[model samples]
Target chain A: MFKPFAFTLAAAVLLTGCSAQSGAETQGGGLADSLPSLTGDYVWTVNAQKSTVKFEADYNGAFSADFSRFAAAIKLNPDAPETGEIHAVVDLSSVRADDKDVTNNLPTPAWFDIKMHPVATFKSDQISKTDAGRFIADGTLTLKGISKPAALTFDLKTDGNAATADGNFTVNRMDYQVGTGSDFKDESWVKFPVKVSVRIEASR
Target chain B: MSASVKSTYTKTAIWLHWMIAALIIGQLIGGKVMHAMDPAPLKFELYQLHKSFGFIILALSVARLLWRLGHKPPALPDGMKPFEKIGAKLSHIAFYILMIGIPISGWVMVSSSPYIIETKIFKLIPVFDLPGVPRTEGFNALTKDVHEYMAIAIAALLVLHIGAALKHHFVEKDDVLNRMAPRIKVRR
Candidate 1:
């Protein structure tokens, strides 16, 4: 009885390992290898009124800041996601925290350094469809005079003349020199991983 | 040692009374010390803990009030003066009012404040603001003053309550203190 049970457990473990390996293989495979590349030029204007960018930081407790002003330019073909291009600019000065003290401190030199770098930009170099209605944009994010490569995975829904894209990604604040000195140098107060989320509604 | 003396309080009442007393004292100290500290992560954590305890005090006060309504407390010792009885009743009434008022005022201040930080009980349970409280600077300041003044009033009353209990135990040599004290068996 013990021998048969051990054999069954081994088989189960092997099947789980094989399934996980295949999942990784599918994701690692290039988008072009799985889907046909669409080849059409389309322009979409980001509706600022319906769009929002928010960042959540964990400092003993979870708190979020919202940016009101931003602009984006998108050129994509739904049939050809690989041919898509996205460029966006976020007004760092427009960041607002729910707490008055945090809101006042956010634009100081220790944090966003909004006086020196008032704008953060993201330019996507490649876009790939990972699953139905799901896509990932591999891009460069420039903030506080530092540029770093970041990947944003988003879900897209298009209806008639309107399209909406929503996604979230985590960024290490230390990488961009945000809150780099004194009390903020360590993870004692504010954790490094800040979750950034975006919801963009655009019109063709 | 007679059973008819009725010298002790019900176990549930005694437990609630002591629990609320200990928590309130700790909360008052935490609130004062945390307020004096500068704005830092530790200060923030202490304030959250203070707020959590404030709500716990409120819940316990409500439960204690309900229990008091259902059960009569042990009577004062025989031959107690009329003025002393009135003083005791009035002071006990004030204690209950302050116990309930301080936390409610704190809740109002938090709910009305323009600063929109979330209130979590013990950093675990998320609590929303009380409805209809205006989120304005003027309103916030008013509620804050109320909360602070009421807290001071509670502190004053706590001193008096403890002093009265001590007097009853040491001077009057009555069961007033023993009614709320933990039960202890005395060997013959």
Candidate 2:
């Protein structure tokens, strides 16, 4: 189980390195254009204040929440929305809930199992938008070596120079079988459904 | 000065000796376990502890040597065989050499290393400068080799020392572990 996780981590690092090299090349030789842009590098800054991510269950009122450190990169082609690509990593381990008890339990092997599976990642296969300014990001969320079909939706707004989008989704932690919850240490009532709110910045 | 050399150590001498022994044991294990870790904030943290403790070994070694000249070591048991005495003395010499050499080399290795500081001393003082011999990229690799090979040699010697002590305890029936033991007997 951890073998694949380790391999993927190494692969992720390598791919990230290659992508950064390519991003650097694309960033050169031009003044970045602002407002409703998609060609240059655009980083989605997670607005923790506006973002609310929570996981709920029968036994627990709200045992899980993700903080503002959530971040990702999106390569959007505003003219050709089909070509837009998104890569985001929610350091689920980085999630700091206001509740101390819940926060302590989140990083354990029985929970996020941060030591073995450190980062939870989402890479979009296809992203589409609705006429209502709401956006849909479809991709496989790889958690603990288990890949599942996951879709996220939220509101997106673009002014003449800047663009912003938000999304919320719930995932049954058991789908990936993150860890078998316990009554004392692990809470089983709520699935690890993460709500994502993102704001991306790009040059025109 | 006598042909029949001494066998016992003074109170302060024994304390320094065992303290160094304890520190070396702790550091070797620390270095081994820490080196096994991948690069992370905590792994680097462990390396800092290991490095600081290593420097302690270097400092203690110097102090121990300085403290030794002022003290009179007790004579060996009058009944010991001649060749055994020569061999015992030779091993002690090796131990002293290794005590200082290995850590100096480690410091040199760290100095030559571009990333790590020369002195992680108390985490207070940063690297001032590396003393003795020119510092270069090549020196780092060479010092690393020296530290590693010296460790192998020291470990081999330690195994031999223990084997000899066990041999005396069971076969020779001499108090081989006596000097390093809880109590030493003095003869008039």
Candidate 3:
């Protein structure tokens, strides 16, 4: 009876040990230990000349627009990415398209409704390093008074004192009440996904 | 063949003529209505469709011109006066020129437009801008005026052409109208 009890204890210990080892390999470390921390903070100012927010939407074909008027506040430490905070505000009235008609319609009530909601904003709550040279910002995007969680994955390249972040994300126009009750309401005419690309150059 | 019978237009010419006529009429109405509407997504889409149809008309006009060069149209009714025959010939020539000119001018307006949008035919075939056309507000305005006026001229000429055809059919009671009719029998 003692031998059987000893074997059961040994088997239990062996199984627990194997599970612990596999868990470590999968997670790299415990949740608390894996959490990133900030080392230093740097103030970043956007270079307007080199920064632009571009959006693309599909109808019968693909159409794109560029918004030149936007502001970004980024506080980041390359060594400790967890402390970074990024906030951006885009002026909806500044949207411009290659076609004059499309440009004119962008700010109308059926679309961006610049008269009511003139600005779209994003505030990042957390920033985490996903891989080498890449980071993800978990944030809330508020447009047309509706706030929703959005994650932006971007690649950061720093050249001495200057840094550039290029990233892209997609949002459903319907979620923001844009293009509602218009001919664009039908997905066949205008698709739901509106892809937004960002190319921002900032300096300390 | 009976002496009283009249010759008819060739099948290719007949089809081209009718197709171009229908498209031109539709485009004229669509263009005016779409332009008058306030800027919206629907208006924008309609403009694109109008532009695509304009390009199609341009292609058909080129083919019609080639067909006209190789094949002769049926002669005017012998009862027509000398001046009437000359008028008919001049009008037909004017029709051909305007049919070709309207589309080309519209194309020039689009090419010179300051807005750098791609013109896709039926949202499928991509059309490049005309070579050497500067994309500037002044240039586009000039081309737009030309395009609009030329379209008006085409519309006026169409009214005359249709009225004359109706006159020939009802008043003159001749084969002038029947010669281009869809299913009218013609002598060889």
Candidate 4:
């Protein structure tokens, strides 16, 4: 009898200890905390009306949804892309799918868990030019409070003061806990990879 | 009321009967399989296909009803009791109502859902939602429940209908089953 009670006490203590650590970690940090300070010649603000942030969750079939509201700030010089920085904030609650059922369930715990983690963020640590008009921004993508290293490659075309970037990237859905459970392990229904595509129109 | 009472059903009646019967059974099984599935892309596709089948059944049911009205069926065997005859008639009426109700209810449920996925029949023909249907969660849930109950009712009706047909064939030893038999030869 006493052994069971002592075991229960130990488990409770361990659970509380874990929660306390996580709580502190989540509250203490902000999305921009780790971003590199940018001092590039051109600071571009993304036009929300003109830009689109969409994701495709594919298994055997493809179901796509879009983040209706997102904002990205870029500081870069076309000549020195290595010194550039990109930061984007996505409102997880604003995700809308063509199917109403999909839209309603997206903010739930199985997917974005928008109640607990309402915002997803990306802040680049490195930006490198692979070719004349193409660049890759490697960054930490924080979603549902889980951070993972991700990369976005885009073709940048600049004409005078206006610029456009069309990019696509793939991220493992399981890595960010988007659909991690016994049911989703096989990936028979909703596949593991989620493709995120972005088109940004911005000006200095 | 005709001078010569027809002993067997017309070819058109037989054709519609078997076609609708096969489709309804398929819909019942497909509905069960799709409902138990986890929410995924394939599940969504199955639902769209299911919707396509539902509409097809609805259309066929309409055609079947019209065909039924224009063509009087062969008279029941002389020995069928009053209640049995009534039950047979009632069950058929119920089937027609259900075949029509099930698909329409499903359509209403789909229309009411807040998430609007376009209904593409077999991923080919685009079928639009019923106009003026309220797209609310409560309405959608209610319609879904109604659709499910209608499906259950149809399943029960199927058991009764098949049992009656089997009884007419094996126990009653009549030509009732022979009327709808696809390729059976009969002496006029």
Candidate 1's docking class is incorrect
Query: Fnat of the models, one by one?
Result: 0.07, 0.00, 0.00, 0.21
lDDT (tens digit, per residue) of candidate 2 on A77-188? 4444456666655545556665554665667665667788766666677766665555566777777767787776645555543444545566666776754534222433
TM-score top scorer: 4
TM-score per candidate: 0.56, 0.45, 0.55, 0.61
Best by lDDT: 4
Over B63-156, each residue of candidate 1 has an lDDT whose tens digit, in order, gives 9999999888888877689998888899889889989998998898888865555788987888888999987768988988888887788888
The reply for model 1, stretches above 4 Å from the true place, is A1-71, A74-204
Better of 2 and 3 by DockQ: 3
The DockQ leader among the candidates is: 4
Per-residue alpha-carbon lDDT of candidate 3 for residues B1-188, written as tens digits (9 for 90 to 100): 54533277878888898999999999999999998986567887898899999999999999999999988888888889999899989998998888889889988988886554678899999898899998766888898899888889889989999999999999998978777777655443
TM-score, candidate 4, is 0.61
Question: Model 1 chain A — which ten-residue stretch has the worst lDDT?
Answer: A8-17
Screening candidate 1 with a backbone cut-off below 3 angstroms (N, C-alpha, C), the clashing residue pairs are A38-A80
Candidate 4 stretches with Cα past 4 Å from truth are A1-204, B1-5, B39-41, B186-188
Candidate 3 has which clashing residue pairs, if any?
none
lDDT of each: 0.71, 0.56, 0.71, 0.72
What is the Å distance of residue B114 in model 2 from its true position? 2.1
Question: Tens digits of per-residue lDDT for model 3 on A11-70?
Answer: 000000011123222211222121233233365555656565778887657999887556
